[model samples]
Target: MLGRLNHVGIATPSIARSIETYKTLLGADVIGVPFDLPAQGVKVCFIDAPNTQIELIEPYDDASPIAGFLKKNPAGGQHHVCFEVPDIHAAVADMKAKGATILGEPRTGAHGTPIVFVHPRDMGGVLVELMETPQEGAH
Candidate 1:
């Protein structure tokens, strides 16, 4: 079972601009900017929310996943909802067993985090991401 909605990933061409917009318009507080996984080609800034988070995702490379997405939709917007899961592998397995379509195998995400994506069709047209909490002392 899922624990809680961890964060909502927002695709943005200019994270700096987006951060300012969120701060001025939505009063979102910048929690932190973490860079621990260059392999993922992402630079992330976490913004706190009442019950979730606004994760600004800026692709470090043109080939980054988010970059490809932005190519199709220039004005970046809400990308995905990441759900915190106690066990990502198990959660993915369960979702698969229940006929959910998976986008990719479980793998490391930004900040060296374990993550996976379930296809939109599986979650009623909303792309969903599953991530395990960073193991204590890992980050």
Candidate 2:
């Protein structure tokens, strides 16, 4: 079951540029250090907000899926919205039973917790990520 709205994922060509924009334009602070997730094929940075965080993602390589997203959206754009789930396995099962298309199996996400994405078509044309609630003080 869904727990809470977690973070919004934004695809970007350059994390540094995006970070600067967030700071200068949005007056955002408390940005997390950018790190590469080779397996996920993205370089990620988190910009903390009052309620949730903004996940800035840049393609790690040409083969990264984010690269494809960037090709369609050269300036990059909102990629997905993540929601916290009490249990990823249960959430996956529920989604399946509800006729929602799961993008892939649950895997570790930027928050260092199990996550799975639902197809955009199945989620009202918006990609949805379901992440298991992180343990206290993690992330």
Candidate 3:
């Protein structure tokens, strides 16, 4: 089952601008340095939220998955909502048994946690990422 709301993922055309907005306007307390996730095909950063975090993701290149999302909404927008789970494998099995559409096998996420994404259709038109809690950093 899901735990706390882990983060709200926002795909953006410019992560720097997104970081600025969270800092200058929201006054976010913890803004992590952005880093590249070549496997995930995006450059990402985190803006701490009171209860969770805001993950700003940008296309690493035209071939980046986010590139397609940005093409649909040039301004970019909310990409997905992530939730924490105690055990990722169990969660994945449960979701599968329920007939949910899993995107792929659980993999290291931007936060370095084991994470898996379920298709939007199975989640009321919103992509859902289930993350293993107390993320073990990917190195």
Candidate 4:
């Protein structure tokens, strides 16, 4: 079942520029260190907010999915919204039973937790990521 809103993903051409914008414009101060996820093909960083975090994602290579997203929106923009789930497998099953189109199988995400993405068409025009709730101190 759905637990809580985890984070909002934003695709960016440059993580460093995005981080600077967040700091200078939003006064964001709790940004996490940026890291690369070669398997996921993204370089990511998190900016902690009052309620949830903001996930800044940049393509790690031309083949990255984010690279295609950026091509469509050169300036980059909101990519997806992630929600926490109590159980990823159960959630994926529930989505399937409801006729939702999932993009792929659950895999480890930037937060070091299992995650799966639901097709945008199945989620009211918004890409949805379901992430299994992280264990304490996991990330």
Candidate 5:
């Protein structure tokens, strides 16, 4: 099962400006730099929250989901919510068993971690992401 809310993604036009704004507003440390995920057509950066994190995403292509979102809601708002799972593969399997739709198989995400996205139809219209971190001593 997924453990906790990993992070909340916010779509932005400029990740650098968003980082600066978030850092000033939240007084948080920019934990991760914006990295482009060519596979997903988006660039992402992160800032740590109390027990979770804040993720900023920028579209790398006009056809990307964020691009569509920005077109409608130019404010560039919350994109998705992510959950941290102990075992991504098992968690995705469970979600699948529950009739949840997986967007794609697990793959490397920001922070050099493995992750997968769940279709909104299965999650009450809210896009959800499952993230996994290597277990201690799992080498």
Candidate 6:
């Protein structure tokens, strides 16, 4: 059902500070350049880890969903966990059959891959993102 743990998303008030923490404290390498996804309304960056990556997400606007999260947390925290799936449509169906609450329709994510989210309540209060494997020479 799940391929692998793709990335762990960390909600942060500032990506620059998080990058420094990952570099200077965690001794991270291969830090990705931050990019803005206006559609998702967030600025994101990735820090490569041995087994998985750390996604640092910051709200792009006041209307950003992360902004709402930050309002409650103020210091930001673990936003979500993303896992890879071989076939997202099949995965979606499987989840639906099992009575999981799919958050929304499948959409192109930051990686330009088809992805969908499962509701937190159904996943024991952890937001889960299911991402389809990015194929070679494909979007």
For model 5 the local lDDT of residue 116 reads 92
Worst 10-residue lDDT window for candidate 6 reads: 130-139
- lDDT tens digits by residue: candidate 6, 1-139: 4488889999999999999998999899889999998888899998989878899999999989789889998888999999999888999999999999998899988788989999999999999999997787642
| Model 4 TM-score relative to the real fold | 0.96
Candidate 5 displacement at residue 83 in angstroms? 0.6
lDDT of 3 by residue, 1-139 (tens): 3488988999999999988888888787698889999998999998877777899999998999889999999998999999988889999999899999899999998877799999999989998999888745432
Clashes of each: 0, 0, 0, 0, 0, 0
Clashing pairs in 2: none
Assess candidate 2 and give its lDDT.
Answer: 0.93
Better of 1 and 4 by lDDT: 4
The C-alpha stretches of model 1 lying farther than 4 A from their native spots are: 34-36, 134-139
Q: In candidate 2, where is summed lDDT lowest over 10 consecutive residues?
A: 1-10
Arrange candidates, best TM-score first.
Answer: 2, 4, 6, 3, 5, 1
For every model shown, what is its TM-score relative to the native structure? 0.84, 0.97, 0.92, 0.96, 0.85, 0.94
lDDT of each: 0.80, 0.93, 0.88, 0.94, 0.83, 0.90
**Candidate 2 ranges with C-alpha deviation above 4 Å:** none
- lDDT winner between candidates 1 and 6: 6
Which residue ranges in model 3 land beyond 4 Å of their true spot?
135-139
Model 5, CA-based lDDT? 0.83
Compared with the true structure, the alpha-carbon lDDT of candidate 6 equals 0.90
Query: Which candidate, 4 or 6, would have the higher TM-score against the true structure?
Result: 4
lDDT of 1: 0.80
* Candidate 1 residue lDDT tens string, 46-118: 7878766788888888778788889987889888998878888888888889998888788987646789988
Look at candidate 1 and give me any clashing residue pairs: none
